[model samples]
Target chain A: MKITCPSFKYWYPRLKSGKLAANDEQLAINHLSTCEKCRKAANAIEALIEDKIQPESDVFFSARLFARLEKSKPSHSVFIFRPVFAYTLLLSLSLFLGIRLGTYFYYQSSIPSENISISEEYAIHSTISGLDVFFQDDFNE
Target chain B: MDENEKFLDKLQSGDQQAFRILVEKYQPMIQAIGIQMFERSEDNEDFIQEVFIKIYHALPNFRRKSSLSTWIYRVALNHALNLNRKNKWKKWLMNGLNLIGSNEQAVPQMPGQIEENAEQREMRRLLNKAIQRLPENQRIAFVMTRIDGLSYAEVAEVMGISEAAVDSLTQRARQNLRKHLSTYYKSL
Candidate 1:
């Protein structure tokens, strides 16, 4: 039986590369000898395979790539709060609060109770005097 | 540790020199991919830079399961495929707009104006178009195997497919390319 074009196509490369078994190689070779179309197709396939585009070369490619990398390198200076830093912050805040509250209470206790009572009495007297003046103004009017 | 692992360690530790060496070593491979994927040299250059940048960002989290080359191939291929898809969409949209806006056809190239090298360039362009028209897996397999000269096993590893699968894909790719080239050649 004659090999179909598709079968020839599939096995042609294998035969060329010597990947096919001897029997398969013989079969492909026999087919190629008789089939003008497959032969032309094979030539075209080889030409296509050989016709690779040359890769353009830049001598300064590495330099430019590195320059770009250097330019675009993300900044590492962003503050990342570590557990230690967080703990230290918490400890400092607690210490500050403790000191502030302690100082407030100590100052509160340090002022004599009699002085506070005197200030309260003065505040009440001042309010009374201000009210009396306001009422006297109304009466005068 | 092996050389790849050591190099990876240095890369992970933010060693710029290691990064330079890595880029120097792999630039050609990445360029090959870029050149295969893009038509314009500038586009290839930009694509290469983008691939390297992606590799740079991805290195820190790399689990070191695959060889660096394989991983790089995977990344380069993925990026090229995505860029190609976007470019195809853009080209289609532009072509549609052109169709609507003007009936004036593009000027044909004069035979006298064609240089000796023009035929080769035209053939290469046609071949690239044929390759681009290939299905994703077949194109990848064919390009990796034929253009980049990767072995079937290596291509399979990069593509995450069995070696036999790569062989089949590449066979199909070659068949398709041959068909396309034959049709083009006959038309001429």
Candidate 2:
């Protein structure tokens, strides 16, 4: 069976702090005694952990941090409904309706009046001049 | 109210004090990761400021899809990474030039900067440089664990991946770092 490369996983914390469990300490020491590669790897990781350093504090920025926090205050409205966008929409809608109505009225107004003229069966007054001719003869008789 | 909800409420109401509190809590963590990922010569302060600006504008629209910290960290990380990646080529060219000028002058080193001592500083710088050289995912995984001290679960939650993925990423990160550090220390 191939001895898989020791995952070296368990060694990280041990290597970092230079402390080891009673059982693992001997094993790590034994392995390092013969394996130069593993030894160097262990020392490097140890150095890294031992070298832990804190970053510099930005006092001025931090002092201003609270003041800066004020700047991040979320606005009440998620979406800013701009007056320009609203007015543009209103104008577009009005223009569209006006154009539609104007087109309809203009088409209607452009039609010739003769196309819808009223037809009369006869000239009523001209025909009615002697409307009682038969009735008057009957009364005299 | 939960801290996050309260913070959301304050933000919605336009309370600047609340915003400042949030930045103070998170900026150090963000700055650490930003430095790990980017060059010291870059405008990291501006980048940090922009992250806050985004959080400010985006807070109103923030849905509770993730925990507030995770969401904030995601935004911060993405912004930092994007900025770093954008300047990568410029950094590479400058790095070449700096390497050539390495012998020109006794570089003015800060006096008290040696507080950590020579060995510790070298190790940290080496570790930082190694992490920075990693692929983006590996680098974030390394920094999130080693520097930020986030738990594997927290890292997983922040990355929106399974715990198993976080484990794998972290393992890979450590494996890579171990290899790089070995090479780095060999020359010393």
**Docking model 1 quality class:** incorrect
- Which lDDT tens digits does candidate 1 get at residues A67-88? 8988997666535466667788
> Which runs of model 2 end up more than 4 angstroms from their true locations?
A1-31, A34-41, A49-58, A63-141, B1-3, B41-44, B93-100, B103-114
**TM-score to native of every candidate shown:** 0.62, 0.58
Worst 10 residues of 1 chain B by lDDT: B103-112
Mind sharing the TM-score for model 1? 0.62
Return the lDDT, model 2, position B11: 77
Point out the worst 10-residue segment of candidate 2 chain A by lDDT: A118-127
RMSD of 1: 15.2
DockQ of each model vs. true complex:
0.10, 0.08
Candidate 2, residues A1-141, lDDT tens digits: the string is 111125354554454335567666666667777777667667767556333324444656655544555676655653425666678888999999999899778756765555543221122222245545554444446
**Total residue pair clashes for candidate 2:** 5
